[model samples]
Structure formats: structure tokens, C-alpha cells
Target: MAPLRSRRRRALAVPVGLALTASLGFLPGSATAAAPQTADAPASAAEAGPELSYVVNTETGAGTVGKVKKAIAKAGGTVVTAHDRIGVIVVHSANPDFARTMRTAEGVQSAGATRTAPLKAAGTTEVGKPEKVREPRSAAALAAARASGQEPLESLQWDIAAIRADKAAEVNPGSRKVTVAVIDTGVDDTHPDLAPNFSAKQSANCVGGLADTGKGAWRPYTEDDYHGTHVAGEIAAARNNVGVAGVAPGVKVSSIKVSEAETSLFYAEAVVCAFMFAADQGIEVTNNSYYIDPWMFNCKDDPDQGAIVEAVSRAAKFAGRKGAIHVASAGNSSFDLAAKSLTDTSSPNDTTPVERTVDPSKCLDIPTQLPGVVTVSATGPKALKSYYSNYGLNQIDVAGPGGDKYQVPEAPAKDGRILSTMPGGDYAYLQGTSMAGPHVAGVAALIKSKRPDASPQEIQWLLKAHADNPGCPTEPYDPDGDGKVNAECTGTQHINSFYGFGIVDALDAVEK
Candidate 1:
């Protein structure tokens, strides 16, 4: 199966999300890098050689970064920025042995390069160009939609009504004080629907592992980077009699771009930067619609994967402690996350993928599977699992309206898909866990708006408490027209693999 993340909003036939497949030429075993040099090696070995990106994880404590700054510099690495709170430092170095030398430095826990390719490789490569084409809605449909207390294109948004967002808006349109940070590709703050409530102060680009707070830094600059803008609209599109309305139309939205311009790849240091930025900026909720790129499952036993898991886990846990409720997609590969053993062929995506059998419990899908994070599964308009949504009893915490073209929601929305703003001030219909995660994030924001003093844990409990639990279906599962069964739902109403705690309820979140 392809290891796509949840943001590849191209051909519906192609899976959304980061692809697990790798160009065979770059496979881990097939390729090699400069081995670590001895401490007594030539002085030139520690001098500047090739500028690379590295994530330096320091020993947890105050002054951890300061303690190792001299050592880092001696290794020919320059500190780009450091999250002293989490002990993660982003560095740029030309030394081939920067990571190796830094690892032996006092007060440094772990250090590794964030990508397989050099820092300059990303700029030269092109990836993740949007391929899907959406047709404009007929004038008659637009007119009829406006007549029914909806925006011109709102009639196509069954997702808004799926969670009863329209009713919730009547009761509570959310609060500007509560912000939902879109930690994805990038957001187009210029979109009319998003501009009204966009929080520029809270936005930044963490593309190269360091946060860039310049103007428009949070907006997508590459082709097909509208995924983040789409997610932002899903959470807090303006309620002004405009094109569409979000779940919490009044809540503020901020963009935190973590992916590269073309690849759409999210590296470990970049993720660490995003969480640290959100925590410091008082972002109440963060919507993580894509997985950390390259590896679908980061096994703790693997040194490289383990270091990434450790660094990102520290960042995520710190964000939670600082009061940001992280909501991430459960991925779109349809793999049962709770299974015992699974074969995964796509990994190290920047290079090549090698098929390997892994125990699901030992392999983790970061941020989503991390502790304290609310993992979300996707449901179509029919409230069934999206054909591509991955499910597991222990993995899913809630469900949301992730459109499925096969089983459309209700009338007024002819297509079975989620409609939201696109880049360049347009709109499109897209589906995936990428879409569903934002709905839950919006609802979380609404809950925060209602209870401003509520802690992240309290808001999490409220989300589960306010959800509408639909028991597992008794019928056999077969989403596609194929003759074979596709999935099996198990568990009770309160907790299940298919629907999780249950479909998120916006109305219940605000009123209950």
C-alpha cells in the first residue's frame, strides 16, 4: 500500500497523505553517507564541509542549549534557533561530521540530520503539485443555496451541517480570543473567508526547522500548497454572508507552515519548531493534518527514528503542558493501527522504501499516536468510515465529516465531499483525514471559547463527553464496488475502532 500522508489533494483515485513509496535508488541499505570521524581525526574533519540541516536534542534542563552552544560551534555547526524549553536546537552546518561530533558533546542527548538530502536539495526538487480539477457549481444551485440562509457555495458543504455547525453558529459563533493554528502546508490568509479572522501575530513558517516570522511567511508559496488554506477555512472561515462558513466561524485562525514548498514534506525539526511556536504564542488548539514525512511508523529501536520520536515527543508534550490541544489526522492508508503485525513497504520516502514487517504497537505514527493528542478518523456524509481512513480501537479518539464521493452526505450537496476555500481566492472539493482533523480542531476551539479557563485536558474530556456515539454497524463492510470485503468495525457505542468516541458534535460542544 502507498504510504501517503493526508494532504496530497490531487487525484481522488490517488491516496491523500505522504506517499510511503521511495525511489528505489535511495533506499537506506542501498545508499551510504560519510561515516562519523574519530575525535582525534584531522582538524579539517571538524571544519565546514557541506551545509546540512540538523536537529540537536539536548539533555533536558535549564541552560541545556547554552551548555552545548560552544561544542556545536566547534563542530562547525551554527545554531539557527533553539527551543530551550524542549531542548531542541535547529542548526545549519557544512561539516559532514556535525551530527557525529555533536552527539559526543557534553549536555547533548541526541543529534541527527533532519533530511536525507542536503539543505539545498529541497529548493531544487518539485513535489506535491495539486492535480485535482473541480468544476464550478451551476448558477441555479448557487442561487437556491443563497435562498436557504447559506452562502453562494455553502450548499455544497454538507460537512458544515454534518456536525450541526449551522445550528451551533446560531447559538455560538465562537470567540476571537480562541485561536486554532493550522499546522500544515500553509494557509492563504488572503482568502476572503479566512482574512477576516486570520491572526498574523500567531503565524510563522517553520519550513527549514527555524521559525520565520516575516510577513506572509505563513502563506503557501509553492504549487499545490493550498492544503493548509483549505484546512484553515474548515475551522474558522468567516460567517459573514460569504462563500462558506467554518465550524467555529468566529474563532481566530493562524498558519504555521511546516512543509517544504514543493515536497510537502514535514521533517522532525520543522515539527518541533511548530509546536514550540504554538506553545509560546498561546495557540489554544493546533490542527496537524499531516504526518511527519518519510516514515509512517518511527520504531523506537531504530536510532534515527528513535531520535526523531524523542525530539518530537518532547515538543508535543511541551505544547500540551502549555495548553495547546493537538488534533492530528489518523492517516489515509487504511492500515489498522491497532493490529499486531503489519507489513509496511513505504518509508524513508525521500530515499527509497523497503518492505518490512513491524509490530504496530512498537511502531508509532507520531503526533497522532503520541500521548495527550486527540487522533481523529474520517467519516463520509453517510457517517461511514471514509474508504481511505485508517482505524484502530486504541488509535482513534473521534470522528468527523471527511467527505467520500462514493457515499454522499445529503441533498443540496450533490457530491460526497468537503468544500472549503482554496488558494488564489477560489474553492475546491477535497476529502481525506486531512479534512476531518480540522473539523475536530474547530469544535475544540468552540469548546475553548465557551470555557476560556478550561485546560487542554478538560477540553479533551468535553470533546469526548459531547460527541454523538453511533454503535458499530452490523452489516459487512464493502465501500468499493469490488466483490471483496474492505474493512470490519468492532467495539461498542461508547468506544469503537470505526467511529472512535463518536462523531464530533459542534452543537453539543457549545451548548452542552
Candidate 2:
């Protein structure tokens, strides 16, 4: 099965003599196997089975809530919450037949369980184990940064410099009024670098498809699941002079935890709640660094996959309509999303995966392909496509520095992976389109901060209009230096698959 991007790290040659940290989560070119569940889910339920989560999608503009509620009840399911405006209903039921029965009910367009595992499934999957890295920076690097009035680790941030974020900060440090919601795993608000700018009121844990506003519930369980924290740090870590700074250091950030606590799976219902929460809270921008799990690509023709896509697509569009701009990663598989056909061996990741060839047009990568969403691809220090970043002639909307350890840029940036805050206030280097999406999001936040009255559509336009169009590489694209061609570039400097309009430009975003 193709491993999910979040769980994978880029392969790079470790500089000799660099001491390895003890907890290196996974090797440079490898991934840790998904942790096994603690116990097997019951094969069959007793008279009263454990409650399972389901999502019921109603036709748009249909005033069918009353009818849907009755149908849910008749199917032995209890309504958890209803996003009536978007026509999505979250439910819980012990009856295995709940989805099948609800499909026949009036006003219900499609209904399906959100997870393959039963609700009673126990145990947790340990994710984001720390990877090997050189020991903490020596006093020399710190002294150099301090002498230059930069953050302690700022010199290592080539990604920021690639888009001239350092220069943009001078133009406008951004405004506190703009909040970029990190809609992934969760954020560690207590990190010293993030504490000054974290927005608690706008944060929530939507792991079970319902909003959990309990105290501190929006934070990740631990750094082991540090994907969200890393993405958050990339967007809005404070310019506190202590740790590394973010692209838009002056903006506020909110944590909207959508991935399941143990499995790290981003289910459809959780994602639905996340977008809705961002909209209701008046968040101006949101960064989606991961795709919905179990199914890597959801085809519209398949009933189950169709429901998943329909429900989440409506929720994302609803967020856009409510004035929030959504930006997402283009995936890390390096496949051409605009291609006619591709092989997908890793899907239904929650269960056994089977190899299947899918038509990219019919099999949509939700949120990324959904209308009004800005799809971001990853570029390395040398301004080339990150070897693993997915691209397409028409799929990419923008490019950003996601780091390529093997394709290091120049002096000061010894490593190619993007560095950001981890759970315990520590920092780590990681790479993927997951790291690239936030660069655009942070730039989007800067745009919103500058034009506070602009609509989401207007902001999206400004984002593309103001980007720096660095055309595709003139030479054959090959980061590994192997003779074989990796991927081909098509289109002009204005538009292409590796980069949509162009690479995101922080300086242009905040400029008048």
C-alpha cells in the first residue's frame, strides 16, 4: 500500500559526523509500519452493538432535516449533529444496517459509515516518532543569528527566504485580526513560539465528527503525532527571537484537530466538522496538509466513495461561501493528478489495500480538487519540484518550499527538509507537500491581513495574481541526479502542473 504522506519522510544522505538523535522515528528513506491495533474489533455484535459513526448527505437546498431526522431514527441511528445548511448529518448507531436502511429513506441522498473499524475498537497508533537529526545547534550558529537580529534558527529556514518571507515581514508583519486555522491533527498552543499568537477560542477537536470544545482538547496527544504542530509552526510560529519564525509571524493561528487520536486517520466526518468550525469562527484561512484516510482517491460513481466526496466537498465549499479560503496539499505520491490513468495500490488504508487503476478525472482527490480550493505543490531549496510532490498539467495551483534533503539549496541551509516546532516546544526537520501547503496558507493569511474586507474569492484571486512566476526548470527535472527522467514539465511560466500560476510570493501578498 502507498503509505500516507504524513507518516513518510524524505530520503537524504546524512552528513557524516552528524550525531543521530536517539528517537529517530523513521530512517531517511523509510517509513515506520502503521502500529497494530490493540484488539480485534468484534466479528459480530451482541443484541446491542457498539455505536458506529456515519455520515448522511442530503441533497443541497433541500429542506429535509425533519425528514432526515425521522429517517435516522427509523434506521436505529441517533443524530449526533446536523450541518443543516450544508446538508450533512452526523449520526451514531449500533445497527449495522443503519446506512443501508437510511439510503431508502426520503430526503437522504447517500449514507455511509465513516470508519471501517467499529467504535468499540481499542488502542492507539503511535505516529510522528522523532527522526534522527544532528544534535541541537552549536553556540556559533546561535551567535551569528543573534548578531544579525534573526531568530535563533532563522538561518536554517531557506523555505522562508525562497519566497522572501523575511523581506515581506518588513513590509507587513501581518495583523492579529487574521487567523489561519490549522485543520489537521491538532496544534500545541503552549509552545513558547506559538503561545503569544495562538487563538484558543477558535480551536476545537473534531475527531469524532463532533466538535469537542473541552479545555485543551484541541492539542495533540503528544509530539508523536506532530504533523499538525509542525504545519502550525510553519504558518504562524512567533518571531519571539527564541525559536524559528513562521511565514506570517504576526498572524493568529487556531488548532482544529480532525485526525483520529490514535490512528491518525482523517475521516470524512471529522473533516466536515473542521471546515464548518473554521467558517463559524470567522477564520479567514485554513491549511489542510493531509487527505481523508481509508480512500486515497474517491470516485464519484462508487456509492460509498461518492457519499464521502459529496459530504466533504459541500462542507469545504460551504466554508468558502462563508468567507474562509481553504488551501490543501497536492499529495506526496509524485503522480500526475491530471493524467488520464494511474495505479493506486494504497486505498481503504484502514483495511487491506488492493491495487486498482483509476481515472484521475473520475477519482477526485477531495478538498484538493474540489472547487474554490487552492491546491499547492512542493518545491525544493533549488526551486525545483520536490521529488515526491504530486504534480499535473492542470492540478497545481501554486508551489512552495517543502524542503528536499537531497537537493540542498546553498550556504546556511545544511538540510533540505523544512524545520518547525514540535509538540514539546522542540523543533524538527520534515518534508512533504504537507509542509508546503502552509506556506501558501500563511501567505493567504498575509493577504487577508492586508485586505481585511476582501472576500474569499477575491483573496484566492489575489493569491494567484500576485504570485512570483518562476517557470519550470529549463533543464530536465531530476533531483536525484539519476540519468532517467523523473517527470516532464508542460505549459508556460504563467501556468503549469509543477506550479499553478507560479510559486507563492509572501512579498507580493502583502504589497499594495
Candidate 3:
């Protein structure tokens, strides 16, 4: 296993009060009363104005949330909802001039229309009937059969197939079932490939209002937001014909809608609630793909923020002790988590003051950064760092095929495609550390299925021990100045910020 490196000197501060609110409006009897009755119609009906979402940019400063709310009211607009973590406000207005006005509002950085539509309800549909497996197949035979196209599978990646085959050989196909909780925008419980694997009777929607209502329920949840479906497919989509195979095909999935959209803050309360529900149902693994920037947490010292972090940490730890594993995306910021600077050469072109260093003391991604959770980074087929993934000698625990944009000379076209389930009865091509997280989570499930006696820590150790080392011939200079890349480390012989323990090798992990 990769040695646990030095503590990151520049871990970012955790934010506070960025949690999502359960109710849309202030309580009727609350001291802070709702706005007085107005002649204007509701904001949703207002003429099509530019849709808007806010992003918080400062850790120590206040956001324009209140101002945005007030402006929405003054402009005859209604706030569909507000997310404190990312400091986003989803509002609708009839006036096309609203965006211009909002741009000038106090505390407002910027506002614009969301790329996706509002959430919708996905109806229940039977993609295929569940079948009982009488026996498990040998790993070698399964791999040979899949290679010969004898099984109905979706992923073209040989590694994924090999991993699944190994998992199938180790356990009783029916006795060892894994339950993966998906915490994202929302999932379409009705999609054919996904439907057979869902534990709907055991699932719940925590996005507010009646269960399964709001934009959260829409079919092909991908139309509005595909994050949840994509993650779910990676963990447990059925192996039957029609789509790609999940890492743990025999595992069951539970949908937990924590974020309404990608930028929205998934409330700490919602997360706790989801974990509690999963615990109650005996779910074995929980996968989180969304993250709020550091500034939204208001720094880790705030009482409220600290409490939320502690609660999440405790819950995840509890799940681990109970035999479940928690996995999360390390984030897409491309920052050197220990040095706290933009690690990606491409980051300069994406943000202001291109060369400005990212402060490590104020920038870690939640849940992933929290203790006890297994954080994962992204890698391509060639096993190189993905340009968009965040990395740190100690922050990231493992890497997986999250899909890199650059082409690989040996396997150019094979470099970046990840085949996973999508909404609307189709498959999709997604690329992110988000895609990488589930791959590890699914492997954890496979380990658990084979060795139900293995503890969470033991499973984590097993994964680390089997990781593929992507040896960098020479360590790059610590450009961001977090201290020279630990001189004690040689090439990729040991851990480095750019690539954690190395690329995930399913065949190696299962064999161990």
C-alpha cells in the first residue's frame, strides 16, 4: 500500500451555513416574517428572463443571497430556491432585464441561466425483469466470454470487465448484495437499465416538498441533470443487454437527491438524513459527486460550520464501522491540495489573475476532504493525471479512469471514453473525478461481496496495496512552492501530489 504521507500543510478551511434549506419560504409564524402581499404574479410565471445561479467567492466575506432574494422580489421574480454552499439563487422573472440588474446588485459576483432545464419527475418503468442467478462464474471464464461478446455488456474498457469478472467469482451472486446510495441532483427511478437495480421501496427524495416531487423527479433526470444517473450506472446498472455493465452488477442502488443542480449546495442536513436512511436500510456504500467551493463553508472555525463537518465526519465514520464504505470525488479544481496552488497549467486561463496561488488554508472539497471517507482522483487509460482533477500527496487516496480529454498515442481513441448509464433509455460519455469515485466505490462493494468479513479500513488498504503505479520519470518542481516535492520520494516509487496511490487496477485489487 502507498505510505501515508505527511499531513497537508495547506488543507483548505471548511465552509459553514452553506447547507440547503428545507423550506422555500420563511415560516409563517417565524419572527422574520414573509414579504407583504404584492400585486405581482408569482416569479415562475414571469416572462422568460435569463435564469440565474450564484457562486460564493470569498471564505471570510458575506454573500449577496439576501440581496438576490430582495431583487427577485422587487423585479416581480420568485426565487425557485437558494443554495448557501455555492451561494446560488435559482430565480425566474418575466423581465429580460433582470440579469443586467442582478449583475449590479450588492455582493453579487455574477448571474446567468443554468445550462440544464428544471428537475422533472421520472415515472416508473420496467426496463427488464430481474432474473435469479443460480451460480457464480469463474473470473477467467467470465473474462473470456465477455471478450467473445457472449454476455450483454456495455463498457468497452477491458479493466471494467476484468473487475466485474473477478467480483462474480468471489461471492454468492445472490447472498452478497451491495447497496450504493447516490447523492446528486436526482435519479430517474424509471430508466430501463437502472430500474432493475433500484431499491425504490427503500429510497427517498430529500430535495424538499413531497417525496419524489419537484424538478427532482423528472424522467431521464439527465435532461435537467445527468450527474446522479451517471454515478448510479457506474455502481450498479444491470449487466443485461441494452447498456454497459456496472462495477457491481449484483448490487442494489438507492437514490438520494441532495443537490437540485450541480452548483447548488447539498445541505449538511440532507446529507445526514441520507446517511441515516442508508444506515437504517443496511446500505453498504454511499457515493457523493457534488461539491461546494471552500468560500461557501465560511472557513472551518465557525461554530455552525464545524458542527456540520463534525456531524458528516461522524456519520461517515459510523458507516465505516458498520461495514459500509463512503467514497467521494476529490473535486475538479486542479489545485495542489497540500501547496494550495493551481496545479493544472490550464487553470491560469480559466480563472482571474492566472498565476495567483490558491491558498491551501482555505480550499478543501467537502466529504472528500473529511476523515474516514475514501477520496478518489481521475486518470486516463494511459494512467496519467487528468487535467481537471485536484491532487495532493495525502489528500487523494486512489485514481480511476475518469476520462481524460487528451489522446493517448498507444490507445488514442481509447484514452477518454467512460461508458455508463444515462437517463432517457440511453448510455452517455461523461468525464470527471465524479466518474472516477464510483469506480472505486464499486470495487469496494466487490471486495465486500467476496470478503464480507473485511472491515472498511481493511478494504481501503486492499485497494491501496493493489493500485497501479504511474511512475513519473522525474518529479516536477513544486511550482506553487509548497516546499520541494518531498525529496524523500523518488519518481512515482512513492506518493506525490499529481498522482495519488496510482491508477486503480481491478484485476490486482480482486486478486489480492
Record all residue pairs in model 1 with backbone atoms less than 3 Å apart, i.e. clashing.
Answer: 3-20, 4-17, 4-18, 5-17, 5-18, 6-17, 20-346, 49-94, 50-94
Evaluate model 1: give its TM-score.
0.89
**How many backbone collisions does model 3 have?**
19
lDDT of 3 by residue, 1-512 (tens): 00000000011111111011100111111111323323233334433433322221111123456755776677555565454333544454444444444555566554432211222311000011111111224576467657765333332443364334435533433223667878665677677778888876557765431235333343332343555676787777776654456777677887877553423335444555566556666878888765531122212433223334544555566566667778877765555566634332221111121222334464344677777778887665556665556677777788766655452424212324355565555455555677777788877777776677778788787777877667553555332346654222223555666556766656555555
The better-scoring model by TM-score among 1 and 2 is 1
Model 1 lDDT per residue over 263-331, tens place: 667888888999999999999999987777677777766545666788899999998999999998887
Query: How many clashes in each candidate?
Result: 9, 7, 19
- The better candidate by lDDT, 1 or 3, is 1
For model 1, the run of ten residues with the poorest summed lDDT: 15-24
Q: After TM-score superposition, what is the CA distance of residue 212 in candidate 3 from its true location, in Å?
A: 6.9
Model 2 lowest lDDT segment of ten? 22-31
Q: For residues 294-407, could you state the per-residue lDDT of candidate 2 as single tens digits? A: 667777766567778889988998888888999888877778888999887766566566678889988887777888899888888888888878889878888887767667
Task: Please state the error at residue 44 of candidate 1 in Å.
Answer: 4.2
